[model samples]
Target: MSYVITQTCCNDASCVAVCPVNCIHPSPDEPEFATAEMLHIDPKTCIDCGACADACPVEAILPDDKLDPSQMRFAEINAAWYEDHPAPEGWKPLVPTPAPPRDRGTLRVAIVGAGPAACYAAQELLERSEVEVEMFDRLPTPFGLVRAGVAPDHPGTKAVTESFEWSFRREEFALHLATEVGRDITHAELLEHHHAVIYATGASSDRRLGVAGEDLPGSHAATEFVAWYNGHPDYADRTFDLSGERAVIVGNGNVALDVARILTMDVDELARTDIADHALTALRKSNIREVVLLGRRGPAQAAYSNPEFLALGDLTGVDVVVDDADLELDPVSARAVEEDAATALRVRLASEYAGRPVRPGHRRIVFRYLAAPSELLGDDHVTGVR
Candidate 1:
């Protein structure tokens, strides 16, 4: 009977402003709004006005009858939030007051990097009639990570980029290709032509393991591994030493999951997506059968999202294992993990793994936590990591 906010929500919180009953918790005024993984609609107090659904620009809100098959889990997820915490009676939805029109002066903006942040900023600016936007990037293509950072198998996530493309095509937007700032042009020069220059250059650098032998031939950062497999032009010609039967990743973040998934996924399944050709050919030649995802904290402290870990289990020909020793939750993290729907999913995945050696010929993803990497042992090349 209640509307559910699904995966497409994106934490934008557009729906909360329009709801009259103010049933949504952690509204932009709440302290948790910034860090909450996604916005949730309180089922207990929802009046079913459908105002929130109408306000969501991404069409992420779903009423009971129209719930998409893949998104049905969200209904249970939304309801679960109020299991222990009861909603107060007579609470009214907070309806947002429309803002006065902005007096956008005749200012020209040039944004560098056409990634998610850049595109979102452009969309916001384009609402005004007096602003003109020009987006620039080094690559000939657009939508940086949407094309390269996302997993080849995640067609739905990649599809989100279409809205950005539509904006550029339909609006009076200008895009300059093969033009990189600081290389082809300098920041000062661009400022001369435009009133404001915004740099949406995302974190391009990867954190190093900082252990000895990190620079060895076989050892690689997850960023490089992801970019290579996704067919990024800069990494298209790069190669990895997947000759070993086992590989170890140093972190347990979403990017680490991406690396493990790409390495373990069947080449045929990847080919069905828009994966880069050169990287696909190299993945087909990989001999790796196991990947150890190392984390410095317990499972409750792990940084990966629940949906990501759950999706890992569904990949073809891959087995995900979680060590029981790492799943123990400290008091604080335990409470937080239990409250989060995504973390709850990860906790369930950890419980499903019993003590057993992973079968051979099948790709294995091992979740190792609360242990620090003392060293990366190797000689001329990475023989075997400790």
Candidate 2:
């Protein structure tokens, strides 16, 4: 009855902290967690206590016998990790950290931004029985990126906010929504009210490529597109030129993959999710059939994780395209691919995509390695990328 972590694993490591037997591998403390697509359970060591299943915010953990046919492979996938790196001997469960002595009065903590980080910080502070928490955010709603950055089609990932529910309901916790720290209230005011102020606000800005024509009307950042589709109030009215037959994304990271997937996604499939009505309406009329992702590095150094790249292959009516020549790795990268398990998997997946035969009617997500966008070719709006 050992549990298996499945495809919806969000990599938040919520399960890792709760497992009493320490069966979850590549934990947040482990070096591999940085690149691990998902956490896996060690079948031999798991006591089947069900703590991980209960702690999983996405409901991605389940008993082996209960797995649906499509998920049965994950059971084998869980065990295979042990073949290469066996579990350490005499592993003990994690012990809870002892709370600090409460010598003073109630420990009041003001957390800025009600995102996942803020919620987790509140959780830690609330553990001290004498602590009180106040969370502030500019938006009336909370959960920051989870609410505004995660793609709607993946509802499983969004379910993480459900875990944040208890943090809001705690009697010791108070929320101040629709209030900006710098404008509505000052940081000095917050400091006066609370003993300590924790700024859990995440990054909202997109980095510039500093290339020519990147500021054209048709050019936009991936963050803008993510917010627009997720119905973030800041970008609700944002629009993309999907009338074009092809769109070129300038990065190969997960967010770039997400943008490509959204561009080529079937309108009917996207309609089933909580996609913004405006974006959905626009998508219904979209003509985009190919999204060519540009990466300055070779396939071995592609920024996307394996799970996301693999999931792209499973998208209906979409083709994952990779040119064969772009896969040729230089000697340095070739050695890295051979020596690094993660790099090997990335190259192997790219090879698989390149080997696939194209389906004419399906939309394409073409991978272009060793390429950079020097200029956005257009008069005012983006017409082509150079």
Candidate 3:
């Protein structure tokens, strides 16, 4: 049995560092690293050390002996990739280089918001000579939406924040918690104190779904749902109604998939993670099973990646259904979409569900296209959405 690298692998390459046998292909420095869908472990070369499994952020790596039935396909996929191209003889595993010693200088930079962008920018600046970085956030916690917006179970994506914590401890970078730019410290004030002020504040508002009944009790934006489950302090008190047997999501982006996963995932599975206490309790009572992901355009134009779509399909006890009619390619766009990786994923999704009817107790994801939502029909409490 060989270790299998599954869908949640985000190309972070943490596993590549720990693998003693160097069985994991496409290390971050490799040419194929960017294009590879996910990391693959060479079955024949693998010594089954299990170090890759420990380093995996999303628990995407599975030991040969512990392979779940759904994950067994990954072993074949991993081994097949290597069959075509053999490993180089006398290959030495690539290792990450240590950073040079920090330069001692006094340039003050103020970063607004603690999201990925801000944290990354700060890390870059701190690498320079004598830079003093001051990071501010409206929330009391420092890591921004990585802690507040990402789904709790998406530990892989969430692990990106670890780099931020390392930057914060550099002594030159100071974190100002619970500091709002406009309310607590004006932009002018920040400018006065720092040589350069970087506004890393991400988009705070959601694009409103203009259809009628969007304000109904059952209606929710993916942002709110994601934030609520991820333990955003602002949305800690908010609640969602997942009592309906079916749900309709307005977008086909990654956020839509995140919401669908949270909604359809077994309550017990989600409860074991760091998901918010309130959100977990609500999920336990959730009756929702089917989620119809309504895309305004064809599958070829979908905004999400193929891996996310594949992960949705591989989820246990959940059946993701696509609409074949919507996936029908226009002659002009077909050739272009077939070559694009992201679009190709959409094409595959369409091909997978050519003529399947949605069944009860299954989490169905409908990829609808060409139809703009004119209105959402529901009164007082949303009874039936149109």
Candidate number achieving the greatest TM-score relative to the actual structure: 2
Residue-level error in angstroms, candidate 2, position 36: 3.5
> CA RMSD for every model?
3.5, 1.9, 4.7
Worst 10 residues of 3 by lDDT: 96-105
Pitting candidate 1 against candidate 3, the one with the higher lDDT is 1
Q: Per-residue lDDT tens digits of candidate 1, residues 165-248?
A: 656974568989899998999999999989999999799997777888888888887778788878898888888877787888
Give the candidate order by descending lDDT. Answer: 2, 1, 3
Write candidate 3's Cα lDDT for 239-298 as tens digits.
Answer: 777778888788877888888888888888898789999998898888886777777777
Q: Which tens-of-lDDT digit does each residue in 186-213 have in candidate 2?
A: 9999999999999999998889999888
Candidate 3 scores a C-alpha RMSD against the true structure in Å of: 4.7
* Model 1 residue 101 lDDT score: 54
- lDDT scores for all predictions? 0.77, 0.87, 0.76
Clashing pairs in 1: 20-93, 21-92, 21-93, 22-93, 22-94
Q: How much lDDT does candidate 1 score?
A: 0.77
Instruction: Quantify how close model 1 is to the true structure by its C-alpha RMSD in Å.
Output: 3.5
- For model 2 the TM-score comes to 0.94
Q: lDDT of model 1 at residue 29?
A: 73
